[model samples]
Target chain A: MKLSNLLSEKRPAILERWFDVVLETYPADTKNFLQKQNNQFANPVGHTIHQGMESILNGLLSGSDLQEFSTPLDNIIRIRAVQDIAASQAVAFILSLKKLIREELEKSQRMDSFIKELSLLEDKIDTLVLMSFDIYMQCREKIYDLKANETKRLTYRLLQRANLVCEVEEPGPQQND
Target chain B: MAKFSAKPKDLAKIRYTPPKTEWTETPVEFREHMFCHSAKPKDLETVGFPYGRAWSAKDDDWKLPDNWEQIILQGMKDLLGKYRSFQLFMDICVRCGACADKCHFFIGSGDPKNMPVLRAELLRSVYRGNFTLAGKILRKLAGARDLTVGVLKEWWYYFYQCTECRRCSVFCPYGIDTAEITMMGRELMNMIGLQLGWIGGPVAACYMKGNHLGLEPHTIKSSIEFFLDDIETLTGIKIEPSFNRKGAEILFVTPSGDLFANPGTYTAMGYLMLFHELGLDYTWSTYASEGGNFGFFTSNEMAKRLNSKIYAEAKRLGVKWILGGECGHMWRVLSQYMDTWNGPADFMEVPKSPITGTVFDNAKSMKMVHIAEFTADLIKHNKLKLDKSRNDHLNVTFHDSCNTSRGMGLLEEPRYIINNVCNHFHEMPENTIREKTFCCGSGTGLNASENMELRMRGGFPRANAVKYVHERYGVNLLANVCAIDRATLSASMDYWVPGVGVAGVHELVGNALIMKGEKERTQDMRLEPLPEKEGSENV
Candidate 1:
């Protein structure tokens, strides 16, 4: 069977197994809330991972363009960027999909015929991993920007107390008295 | 896989060792991605805050008025004269170190500056330099430090780090309220223009639009309507909640976060369902929509400004009394400060629970009753029918919010309602609850996403206690009264306890409420399948 045919047929099993694998990164106790509490707002971190995994799986199976993968890839990476995981560990879930797929195919005894197609899928996932690394870096950078910004804002009064700077009325269109 | 690479050596130790370094020499490290974003200049300016120029916390110079030093000293002098608590707190300190290990931040991060005594001493040191005669002569020998830029930076860092939960006061033999000192510190910071955006932005929004999310009149109506639609779908009951309707006997006020966010929205649905079933004569004002005052975290004047609208709206709507929802600081303001700042509420009568006809003597001054107290009264009278089995799936633990627990003595009311509504109720370690409760770590405007690292560290003690109950009893549900808790504890639970979920006390109330003519309920307010339904499906 072609890889696409195998993937389309085994999508549900692949996604479930992949979700469990991703959830395994969290502590054993946290997995139930991440799995059972399904509301997007109530369990946002859980929702993000679950939805991100599903979208990534669908994108992988369909072999969609890289542009189509941006939303899910960004969602998953952004969440992982803040979590207690190393940068390598953060994007490791992308690579875990390769193993999940291989195991699912092996369960159906189609691994020998699907080898070349699986390699093609692996290459697609490698591209996704790079994209994820970029997203993670961006999230990390944004966090730094916020920290610097907060430090300035929080310290503004202190600077004022020290007589470092003075407030000058800006002559803007909105500044009319 | 274990979440932490390095486990704490001892999670149960409750002792402290003061660091050898002098407090002044101890510099704060600004870790990346661990602080909340700065308030937008436009938002600050709108609220008339002295925010000028684009600035970053990493900047060398913060733009200020030319006479900033004089301004700070004058502000201190003003505060000292006005508040007797400030004067008393400034003058006396035995430093017995009873509160040394009480703070969640100190417990989690092991930072000496986080100690309640040291945290207050940061300000008291400045006071010794400027105010006291001994400090004028003895200076550093008397524990007095000159108000330098470095000291100011230390103040900003540590004060923001405090949730102002007043955990320290309970242990203080002198009964010095560190939260009072923190409020004064934040107010003094506002004197120079150092205000957090997470706090200032909501203050601005709440000032202009009557809610923190900045939802306008129509938006508030539509938001409530959206919850009504969800309630209708879940229970087959359509609740008609009146907004700004006059001639109602009572005015209902809740945290706008409830009208805007999840878990909170479900709690809001509980309010509507309970009210609709009782046919209670109540009105919600979109104009005075928000109950939680971020301004209280800013300054007393700003707090009073925001609080004025609540009573102003109540008077305008001609309601006999006000009914407050499950919020923390809002109650602190209502119970402690609101009457003093914006009251005489002479136009209103003492709040009487219409169901039980119990006059709320505790709230006689403000004429506002807490929803928990109101619900507890109903349950006491057996007015509303509750199906405790509906919530049997949850092993519930009630987290006593700091303000509600300390400020109002509202300890028994929430627990009474929770015990009546849920079958399995567990309490966290006694030291970590009731009047001795730990903060959610993200209260008092520290709930911003950028401060996740700081919040998690501060949340560790509370989460540690929750983990104790969770591991022992399989307690999955964490219930509380504060809207900020509803918003922030989810993240804390995700980080620390993992599978444990956070809910408002009322969200559980909504789940257990048996309506007049509802569907065979298969889902809770989150639309998650009910445990019984799941069991039936399996069968």
Candidate 2:
């Protein structure tokens, strides 16, 4: 059987295992809460991760283009980007899927027949890892930008109070020289 | 540069299981970006806080007073005796986990310790270990743990993680206010001079300078002058608001953040424009310049000390009653604690709206009225002309400031005004607003930049709700009454749901208010061109 058909067949199992791997990044107590409580507003981080993983899994199963994965990738990576984890660990969930897929394929005893397809699937995940890195960096950069802008916003009036900032004059039509 | 050497197999070897040890046995790791900086010794000394020595959360030696354990235990004992709510909360929790998923931090971070129940347990465990006889006998089986340095570290880490927004209390079957428990935890920490710089610095500044920004009297005046300049440029009307003037009809106090921060600065301009248009006889007091009391985050005594100025300033200025600006905790303090803390404002009369001639009998004792209530009355009486289309550019949604909604129940007034002013308005999910509002996640002085990650995590639920509205209704403006919401939610919206802006409700009101004798307006209070004039050169 083809790896794609096999993946489609094992989509639920793969997605569950992938989610467990992501949840493993949190503490045991947090992991349980994230897994059990499913309300979107009440458990947003968990809900976002679960939903994002499902979308990415659906995208992967259908062989969708990389661009189709941005929203899902962004939803999950944006969360991990601010979580208490290292950058490597933040994007590491994307790569862990490769090992899970390989194990599942090997368990099905189809590794030899689908080696080329497996290689292509792993390549797609590698591209996803890079995409996640970009999203992670974008979130982090936005945080830094927010921090700097907040300081500027907080001090904008203080600077004005000190006469350090002034409104720029709108340029008028120049008189003939 | 460090090379990316780990292979997929190696990375996959990362453990998926938590350690087998019990949660109580697990020590907290104070990771980078997880906590705020320690209070400076000078800031503590400024407010006469005990054990005013330099300390850092990262350092092994906290330089704590030698008898720190005794101080904390005794402080806990004293608090239990003094506040019935604290003691009742300590003893009453069944830990049904009703509040487990309610805290925004818990929802966002998924840290069990961030759960309101467990966060309270961090203290309740110590209460069991030290105070109860059955706990001493039963010990580990009774969920009791002594207040060791490790536990103290856990307490500091987890308690600071809570914004004390009280969403948990709404869900608790026994009405256990986790916020008061956190307040007690903070008070106990404060006894040993363990305080966050973001909070402690403001406490000292508010105590000394009458505002958290440490702006002197002249600087406060000069700040308002800048807002006046902006107001003039927007409306072609110069407003000359008085300060420290005797015999004014009312005294206005607002969070000093409005005087110094963006979005908040615009809110202050909104107040200036509104007051000017109403021709209100109000005087701003440099003595009681700030309505926000950062001291409330510290201890009951400090909160009273910081709050005493408003009534005192009102009396000194000989005003009839005090008018508070849009602030979260300020109203919480004013409506709940201020009357008991510093009342018999027998000297001041009950607040009556000058334009509408409406009596604020609810504020008879405190002699203070929220600006939302004041403005709602004005709108009810048709006292001010409004052009709702002036705010047509904004698809507005109101974020009920946690303190204002849960703390004082000042709910309908802001909405009534928003519905009157903005043409387009949407509500977030029913669960995320009103008395059950999620915090801006940076309230109670947790809005520091070093902990931006933590704030964003805590603010995720709020931003998530805003994102829902943004996607569904194209909500570009989040209108709120709290000054902290204005400042902190700005960063949160930028991080979580970019393109949605945070503004005070009155800022919307300022945009929509058609002030008498003003020139044809071309822009909103933030000086952005009005939607109709966006492409016109006349602007």
Candidate 3:
């Protein structure tokens, strides 16, 4: 219809403006629970996860406090799995492997350049997680599109059915004749 | 420097507290007695639209049969048209409920669907169902449904309920105009021959004649002459007003109601006297003289058709510019629709009030200037001798019409004139003032004699505010600048808000008028300080 509408379908909205909403709103209250309950994360894995979370947080909080006010849902644990996603699923798989690797290193109390090694792994994990999220979000949007189409199909079918039933169930003048 | 535009004030402070004063008042509930749109919708039987009122299709003139498929498609197509704001509204109206409380009708009547967005949903839901592929297949899930007789009735009821005051537009994030949608919906309803009797009658009257009040050429001329005589008696300035002056510098178009009726006739005289005093060239056209458009009443074609006369008259006159009178909806129609078909004319220049010699380029092409601005300009430039003390005894409150205030961004011009002309000036309140102003308990041409209940609702908030000032500050005069608002307030005075006398901003100017003779006399009890004109140039 309008020119801008056609372009909008091809281009994405300026969502980066609202990206920080995910960080500040994402439940800072859950930090102690995540750190204390899981200890394979203790020295090495914990440091890697924290580094990944920090990197994600840094990318998310910049624009408007008004945006945060409108959208209050900030906690995201399930989205951690969403973030580990990558174009090459191998990167995601490799990023997840660092959690266990760091835990193993910490159990052995390996201190030489331990923090430095873990930081690099955590950064890689963060990249993989972001890429995976991008991929997953695109997929989810497509899936909703499909769901919407299916909903339309059902509604049309229902309307047709209702129309037919009304025509048959109710009398017309010719039929009365 | 950028032209002066008041940035919207932060709306952090609106309270339910009433003004504490002992005086005549009506409870808010009694005044808010109006009903609209069927909420919590439900389809009775094999109705095509969900939640549609069950009705057998009939060929009767009143209750048209269900043409759900066609209507839904049409509504969808109209909404998805080339208009950018219309399209934006379709996509971005997240139904955030931010605009829920912004509707004057909603607040006054306590009707949820009267809320601007909810009223929109009546048509929008159908648009989604019929047009969008997803909605066609899954209408129920998306909350989209077909349009039926019941939905059609609700559309008429609620859409008409909206005066299109644009109170909702202020709160919309995308700056989408619901008035646009309301206009479209009204147009659609008329196409189906489903308009209210009162609105339909006026539209018919307007189409049959050149004016809404059905003033034949002779009648229109006589009304002007009679008003000129009234002007003579009131201000002692007398000269026969010439008509159909082809080469006149300006064609002063006013609503026929004013020319034919009381109080309004006097305001028309004020403009004439000001023009006469300033030695300005102006002519009034009997053909295009009527400014209030009934096309705004029922249909856009009708609105367009009524408005077309102005440009047509301007072409007929070959005049340099056109100036609108003190009518309400007339300016709204001009602001929104005049440029759409009859574009910027090559002949007429941008409006320059010859009285004050002020160039109103801001109100040039698509813009409009209320009479207050012209007079304010005159007084500011020392063009007219003003008798400010003539209004000394009257404690006046300015009633800003929804059209003049919210529609055209006019707030200061009237007060500017009144402050100079009157003694004591006051405002209504904070949030309920200016662009966020309340309706005059009746406007949108729905000020019908039969629809008492709805009229009562529309005027509730306005009456309450007037009652508030009348009680607390002892302000009895409601001095609004719009003619229709003045008329509506007069009708609602004893019925809605008691003990309030409504006058045009010009009438206040007239009251303090220092005529050509008879001054320095406190003969009348009003204690009018006579005319102050000594060296002011006479037209």
Candidate 3 per-residue lDDT over residues B1-539, each given as its tens digit = 01113334622242212233321121112111132222111211111112223222222233444674475466558646856666667667887766776666664443456778878887777777776787888877776866665566667667878888887888888787888788777766655454544454455555666676666777667656655655555555575777888988878887766653444555666666666666668788878867888668655555777677788888888888877778777777787678875676655787887665689987677434567778888778876667767666567888777887887777898888888777777777666678877777567767554444465546656665665677778877788777677656665554434577776777667665565553343421122334453433222
Which runs in model 1 stand beyond 4 Å of their true positions? A1-177, B1-20, B533-539
Q: Score the docking of each candidate (DockQ).
A: 0.02, 0.54, 0.01
iRMS values in order, in angstroms?
14.3, 3.6, 27.8
lDDT of 3 by residue, A39-129 (tens): 2211112233344444333333222232331111111222222221122321233243344445445555653446664565466446545
Question: Which digits, one per residue and each the tens of the lDDT, describe model 1 over residues B233-327?
Answer: 89999888898999999999999888756567778888998999889999999999999999998889999999999989999999999999999
Which pairs in model 2 have colliding backbones?
none
Write down the worst ten-residue block by lDDT for model 1 chain B: B11-20
The parts of candidate 2 lying over 4 Å away from their true place are: A172-177, B1-17, B533-539
Clashes of each: 9, 0, 24
TM-score of 2: 0.96
Q: What is model 3's DockQ versus the real complex?
A: 0.01
TM-score of B chain for each model? 0.94, 0.96, 0.82
What docking grade does candidate 2 earn? medium
lDDT of 2 at B297: 86
Q: Is the docking of candidate 1 incorrect, acceptable, medium or high quality?
A: incorrect
Clashes of 3: 24
Best by lDDT: 2
